[model samples]
Target chain A: MTALPPPSAKKLGLVIDLDTCVGCHACVVSCKEWNSQSPLGAPLADLDAYGAAPEGTFLNRVHSFEVTREAGPPVVVHFPKSCLHCEDAPCVTVCPTGASYKRAEDGIVLVNEDICIGCGLCAWACPYGAREMDGAERVMKKCTLCVDRIYNETLPEPDRVPACVKSCPAGARHFGDLGDEDSAVSRLVAEREGFALMPDQGTKPVNRYLPPRPRDALPEFDVLAPYLEPVTEGAGGFLGWLDRTLGKI
Target chain B: MHPAPSLILFTVLSGLGFGLMVWLGFGALVPLGWVGFVFWALAYGLAGGGLLAATFHLGHPERAWRALSQWRTSWLSREGVLSIVTFAVMAPHAAGSVFLDRPLPVLGALGGGLALLTVFSTAMIYAQLRSVPRWHHWTTPAVFMLAALAGGGLLAGQVAAAGPLFALLAVALALHWHMGDRRFAAGPDTAESATGLGRIGKVRLLAPPHTGRNYLLREMVHVVGRKHAARLRLIALAAGAVVPAVLLVALPAGHLLGALAVLLHLAGMLAARWLFFAEAEHVVGLYYGRR
Candidate 1:
């Protein structure tokens, strides 16, 4: 009789700090570079290269938005969007084939690309729109959480991290064993408030975003600078020009 | 959600195939005895083949057996189990019709019920997917029932010698038409409400997340023009239901007209099934820049 493998502990996940992110897009580039050469096959690409509409492949994208505050300067929120690897992954369940499966040990959702027929049902099932079908390969592709790099035994212990986390210039991205209660990510979750995007769907996304700090402390003069610039320019220019032309001390 | 051509063909073709089987099998049950047994076998075989062909659309046909394991939670599993049961019932029924001296009416009735149940299970598979709001309605089951009733009725009218059965088929055609009309009328309002932003306000996509078209847009945002859909619906209703009804009424004069009606009804049913998928709007459509 064959013996079954021992059941593993809880699945580890990620918690990103959106508050400190400066939208450098280094994480996006790093994610593409790492996944492109992985065993899972490349999902990103450069399309219409050397043309007017050239674009490159990216698994993660940083989006910048200006949120107008009531009493301060507009807060610029930088959002990094990628797969959350939810517990109730619709993408996996809706698959007619067993190509998509959530890891029993880590809860990291992965695709067995070899078995995928590229029928695209998994893409439809995802509300977050995380999975993208590689038009060239004719298979669905998504963020793998840098599984290969994170677990590689050949690499030095300190260097063993997701490419996105390593490349984040602003220290916005953090990767650790979220399943462990005393891990850095878990402690960060406890110290700061974190929220999942579209929590109403109840997919139980693993990734979390720390809210941007309030902009109330900024000076009122700085807030009014853009609106008051024209009025100040008219007065200052005329007075300065008159003084300059007359050679007044 | 990205309507695979193979799947669309499978569902529509099988709907007609199984629908025809139900009518023929039921005919064999009611007083007709062994007269319509050959037609019943043909219908069952066609429906079985259509259902089997649908499995080709799956990624792993080897794992297809596993689908039957989840009948407790999945309608898809129920459909698979019911389809197999239908086939099992059909084999014995077909063997009896061809080989046995005496027709087994009880077996015929049981087979007929199983065939109908198979179709119901297939319909319920779609009807139960709450994520696809358009499919999760009474209309889904109603349409499947209508397809079976109409197709079966048309087949029965063609093969059976009994004139009263033709009148019964006429009633089924009328009911199919009525239900089809009602189904189409219950349009995209539920979808609008599900988004939680629209009652009477105009909502439009100002900017999409990306310039390149992705799977979500391709799958959910398929739009058919209203004018064309309306025209097709009318044609299908007339050819599938009204024309068949007229033929059934005229069957007393000549059986050839009944045969013509069956062909017309099949064509109409195919068109109607096409429109069924074409007109359906998934709630995911809202995310794909459609309101």
Candidate 2:
């Protein structure tokens, strides 16, 4: 079962706008809250819940970086990373137990906890660090794209996306069939030039991140005008200049 | 990239066991009568015990049998299947040699070949991982194969064969170290590429994903000091290859020399295996600016 199926026509994926993400960690929290109650890798236990240096498995994480250009104002780029649901997901192929697999219907990658030995090879195979080994549950955990929620008919249509996508306050996350050229997510990708995390790795990730648009230059300000005026005065000798500069200031 | 001690021991001990089995297959060091049992016992003990130790690393050892079901794609599954086949084939070969006091040449050769294949499969488990550039190279499996040959030769009491095998091991180890260090220094991937922020300028870590050490960082972000790693590499080379080769070539064939050589070589192999894991640079480390 680890042998990948032929590429599916409906490539369901997420497109994240890096420009609008505020590094609020809300998506991470929402993902945790929803998945902790799901069938697989449930009750994602924290080794030290209330103690110092709490550690646990998470399906998604936000990393903040300070990008400094030599001439422009520094900008903080917040990157939200998760399972890309790759066309050739290494995590799926490297699983020894056939527990990690990709759906042939919609290209959603998932882990079957029933057969997982939790040897941690899938996690090591992942270049994006999207897979997490849930030690307490004894299985590998990953972003399922909320298969349970998305397909559940009981939930209202507006509330039927992945928890992270539905809860994002900044509306940075978008989900739809990317295989459709005219889909909103596909159009966004086309317009914004969304990119994969490491294209050279050949994962061909379904999820994309739109880069932050280039910032405009700051407005001009005469910060030194008041201090410079007295030093250039007409009466200037060393002492006169010093007195004027001191008195004027 | 965390150098789990069990895995280091697993590769070293298993390689030594399977290597000795190869020698026994070729009648290179065939002991007669009752003594043959001790030899086969030691070989199977090291290989089987090492494999058992590896299972301890799994989160659910009870479900470890499920690992064999996915051999079509996974190197880990291939390793599992090959290990089982190697043991099944080698068992009868060991029985004929010990119980019948005779060598089954054809059967022994098949078992020996499978043993070698199992070792290659084990190496491929790491070699196939593109996520860790340090381990994803031809040199990884080559190094594993060479170490098995060299260590097996010494353990099988083939002093003459040990000399040349150890020499090849020395050259291979040096090349592996040189390439691994250079790759770490200037590989293609970087933090900028990881985040797709290279167009902006240099990217620096402003804030980590969390204040605490998460599972990803704990398992994949291990860092070793450059100076210490260099020193360890030298020690591994000397103890594993140079000293063993020199002793085997210059000294008389005696129990003391053989025992001393095997012990030192094992220590060296352990160090090298530890470095193999500890020094690996996982691509995920780029996100945390660990690269």
Candidate 3:
């Protein structure tokens, strides 16, 4: 079962727009909240909760980086990372126990906790650091793409998406069948020029991140100009004479 | 990358155990009756003890049996299966040597071959991990095999064979170290590619995903001081290969000296194994601005 099933035609994935994300951590909060209560996945473990050191397992995380461009001021990019649901997910193939597997139907990767020995090889195999070992349950946990919600007949159509996507205030997170070129998410990816993280790894991640748009440059200004401007423009002042002499020279 | 004690012991002890079995299977110093039983006991003790240590590293040891079911794809599973097969095939020979004072040459050779394959499978567990560039090279398995041969030779009291085997191990270890130091930097992975934001210029982690350390950082990101590591490498080489090889070739084979050599070799192997896990740099660390 660890051997990957043949590639599925319907590649369900997410596209995140970096230009709009505010690094609010709302998705992180909502993810923890929903997954803890949802019947689909096991509860995320938080050891030493309400204590000095609270370590827990989370399916998704947001990391912010300061990027300095050659032409503009440095900008901060907030990167939200989770299971990319790669076409050749290394985590699945490396699993000693067949607990980790990928769905043949939609290409979604998942972990069957019942058979997992928690050897932690799947986590080590992952280049993206997407898998986490639960502190209390001691089982491998990952972003299931909200398998329970994505196809639940009981939920409303709008609520079928993953919790993080549904709760994102900036609308940075978008999800749909990326295999379909005409799908809205696919079109959005094309328009924004979305890219895969660590393409060199060859996992062929299904998810994409839209790079930040170019910023409009502001006019150059000096803080001390006002104080120096009045003196320089004046009436027989030393600075005025100096400027005039330099101009004449 | 945390250099867990259980794993270090597992690899070192098992490597020595299986290595001795190879020489013994080939009919070297085939002690009969009680002596044979004692020799086999030591080999089984080290190998079985190391295997037990490895299980302690698992989160669910009770479910460890499931690991054997996925041998088709997983190296870890292959190691499990091979270990079982090697032990089973080697059983009759071990029993015959101890109980009947006889050497079952055919069964012994097959088990010995399987034992070597099992060691190779164990090494592949680390070698196959592309995520950790330091352990991804062919040299990784080569080093493991060299160490096993030399250690096994010494443990089996094959002094004639020990000199050359230890020499090869020393050379391989040095070459592996030289290659491993440059692997990550030479490879395509970098902080820029990891985040896919390098087109802008330089990308650095301005704010981390969380304030507290997570499992990834704890398990994968570990660094050892350059001076300390260098000192340990020299010590490992001297104690593991040079000294033992010297003692075997230059001095008379006496009980006290042989015991001392084995102990020194064990200490060296332990240091080397610890460095193996500690020095490995996982690519995931790039996201955290770490090596």
Candidate 4:
């Protein structure tokens, strides 16, 4: 059951834009709010919520990095990390119980909480650290891509996307079938040159992160004073020179 | 990795137990009377006790039986299945030797082969984890097998074979630990590669998502200081392999000396297993800028 299904024609995934993300934790919160109450990982455990070290299971997290470019200004890139839902997900394969599985229909990796023994092997197998152990429930939890919300007929079509994608204030997150080249997300990846987190790992992650755009150089101009110029010629006094110049003109 | 005490104990104890079973199956150094019964009990106790301890580490120990269902793809499941099979095969072999007063050569050979396979499967559990580069090596399995043979030989009263076995274990441990240390020192994956930010420049973590420890950090972001790690490595090598080899060579195979060698080797292997888990670097660490 852990063996991956044959390549699906429709690989549903997310595309995150690094250029547009402002590191505002809107998506992270929205994802928690929705999934915590949903069936995938209901009531995501929060240990010592009001204490010195409040720990909780989170499906999505935002990390900020300062990249010091060679001979260029250091760029602070806010990276949002989540489940890549790899095509060859090791987390799925390593599960001793058949609880962790990938959906052949869409390639979304999920854990069957009813069957999971909570051995913590799946978390160890995941390179992205996407899966977290829910302390109270004692089961592995991760991003479900808001499967409940995305598939619900009661909600409007616009609200059918993942909670993270909908709540992103910077419009950094995009969701669609990545397998189809003509899909919106796939086209965006093509145009933006999106890339996987660790291609060397060979996870074949479905999601892609579009790197930040190249920083532009400053233009040749004095920003402080564009109109002012020093007087070059005034042989006589200021008034005499002005009158002479007026007469000559 | 967190290097949980339960897991360290599990690998070390089970390795020693299964290793003894392998030697017994080959009819090596096995005594003719009450001593053989005692040795069988010791092997089973170590293997069974180690397995029991592993279940305690699980969040749902009551559901541990469910783990045996996915043997085809999962190394953990395969280990579970093979362990049970080894026990079944060895039990009959033990009964024949103890109750019937005859050694079942065929059964012993089968059980011994299965016992070694279980250890191999156990090693694969770590080695197959591509997430942890330190564990993802051939040396991991080699060290595991050597440790089993060395420690198990001492337990089985095969002091003559113990010398060479201990030497092999020392070499394997040294090679594995040295390589693992070098791998950690030379950062393979970086924050830049993790986030695809290398094209831009050198990426460093300015701030983590949270100030407090999260599940990921608690479970995967284990960092041991360089000085402490070096010191522990020396301890593991000296206690686990060197001391046992010296004792086995110096003293004849008496009850007192054999007991001392077995205890010392077990202690050493425990240290080695601890280091094995403590030093593993998970790729997720890159996101936290700790790789």
**Prediction-by-prediction clash tally:** 2, 0, 0, 0
Q: Tens digits of per-residue lDDT for model 4 on A183-239? A: 999999999999998887778999999989988988768776745655554557887
Per-model TM-score, in order, reads 0.71, 0.94, 0.94, 0.95
Predicted candidate 2 versus true structure: per-residue lDDT over A59-120, tens digit per residue: 99999999999887899999999999999999999999999999999999999988888899
Clash pairs for candidate 1: A11-A106, A45-A57
Model 1: CA > 4 A from native: A1-9, A16-29, A40-80, A134-140, A176-193, A211-249, B24-41, B52-74, B101-110, B158-209, B224-227, B233-256, B283-288
Residue B208 shift from truth in candidate 3, angstroms: 0.7
Where model 2 places Cα greater than 4 Å from the true spot, the runs are A219-249, B224-227
RMSD in angstroms, all models?
A: 7.4, 3.6, 3.7, 4.0
Where does candidate 4 stray beyond 4 Å? A221-249, B184-188, B224-226
Model 1 over residues A19-104: C-alpha lDDT tens digits? 78887788878888889888767556666767776555456765454444445455555667778877766666655456677777
Docking quality category of candidate 2 according to DockQ thresholds: medium
